[model samples]
Target: MVFILDTVMCIVTTMPQTKVPLSKRERTARRLTLCLMTEEKQRRPRPSVPYGPTAKTVAEGVQKMRKRRQLTIYELSALLKKAGRPITPSAIAKIERGERRVDVDDLMALTTALGVSPAALLLPLKDSPHQSIEITGAGEVPADVAWEWASNERSLPLSSGDASEAELGYQLHSLPPGRRYLRSRPVGRAVEALRRDVDRVVEISQRSQSRHPSEFADRLAAARLSLGRLEAELARMEAEREEFDRSSREELERLRQEAARLVEEQSRGGGDDGAGVD
Candidate 1:
């Protein structure tokens, strides 16, 4: 059946159309070829959708970075090729013109060629620190906020209020351990800074009490109130950290066990196959 179809296709395609009267077999072959071509066209994947805002940002960044580095489109293409992810200069041009969508592989190659982070390409240029960026699903956010979120410095807050540790943990859970540490570092430093401020205020209050007993009452009361609020915040942060740690350990163990199970199953399957062969 396949050979017959191939022969029909070859005759129908290679034979030139002529004004001569057609034979019955020739007409049948032509119909079969037309049907097969239509089916093949239907089976082919559709072209990608138009580039979105994020893709436009990457395109702009690629062009901007390339120019800043004193590279032409061809030079940038050469660099990408050297990095083992070659994009033709014409395709790079289309990408810069927002006529081509930059996929993940292209984005990585562009980042390497442009000597910038993927976040740098993904985020729009910071014309002003206060400029608002329209991130899909997240709506509009400040440029600095967008950069921070993209860089994994902090999680993007989708809600109206401040993002809680649970949200942060959720974001960090999928990240590797090194990235999780980096992402959580800024918050940890802020907590430590607040603790130091509370400590300093308490030490000052104690010294004041020793020197001027009368003034110490109001000062001590204010310090106590402030300290109480800060202490509550500190405790909440501590609890959240512990919770994040516990969840991370559990996830890691689960992944490890899943991997081991797969390995064991593959080994057993291999042994059975070998026995069957013998």
Candidate 2:
């Protein structure tokens, strides 16, 4: 009885531990769960505005103008798409939320879509010194006109008269220290492209007049409207170009005068030195 008991104990102690192999499905599920847990631990929330406060201000401005214009995100997106620079509703939402930074092209597109100046979206409107005021003497100012000089003032001041208040404000915002505006080259290029479109429309109008007089009557009206817009844009570009040229010329003249003065001084000093040596 003792030997049998010892043999049974030995058998129990020597017995191998049972092991179960995991099936393919179990292994996959285990891996997926581990991956999910790791991902959850690693994930972090993104900031609302990656570019900081300036970007947030711009975002707010975009939202403000959009709302003021009573435009839906989808409608704004569609307008931008029609302008050949397509943006999605989701992307506009991100911009308004300050989650995304706006690029130059998008900024221009937004300005076009929103029917507001780029300055409207860029500058802080609350701090502007200039405000719209109605003039008493205007015979009949259109509802669309935003600014009119007071009737008591005979003429607009030279400094402010050349450009609209919006343009002046944009120029001021972009001056010297920081230069927070689009380049003149891009503006010029856009104007040139638009001018080409205007030319094409003119050609169509001429052709229509000969081919179909009835069509010409309709097309002529549309052509005039297009011409008016094109001419306005062209005038703006010309004004900017003229200002640039004028400044450059003035600077050059100043430098030339400075060089002449230096030359005169040097000559005078050399003559004095020669007399002393003599």
For candidate 1, report its TM-score: 0.49
Candidate 1 colliding pairs = none
lDDT of 1 by residue, 1-278 (tens): 87568656655666536787889888777767766676678779988766667877888889988999999999999999999999999999988898788889889989988888998888886623338887767877887668766865556766765568656675567568865674466555455445444544565565565776655565456556656665676788799999999999999999999999999999999999999999
227-270: candidate 2 lDDT, tens digit per residue:
66667777887998999999999999999999999999999999
Number of backbone collisions per candidate: 0, 0
lDDT (Cα) of model 2: 0.63
Q: Estimate candidate 1's alpha-carbon lDDT, on a 0 to 1 scale.
A: 0.75
Candidate 2 residue runs with Cα over 4 Å from true position: 1-33, 41-43, 46-49, 128-278
Q: Please report, in order, the local distance difference test score of every candidate based on alpha carbons.
A: 0.75, 0.63
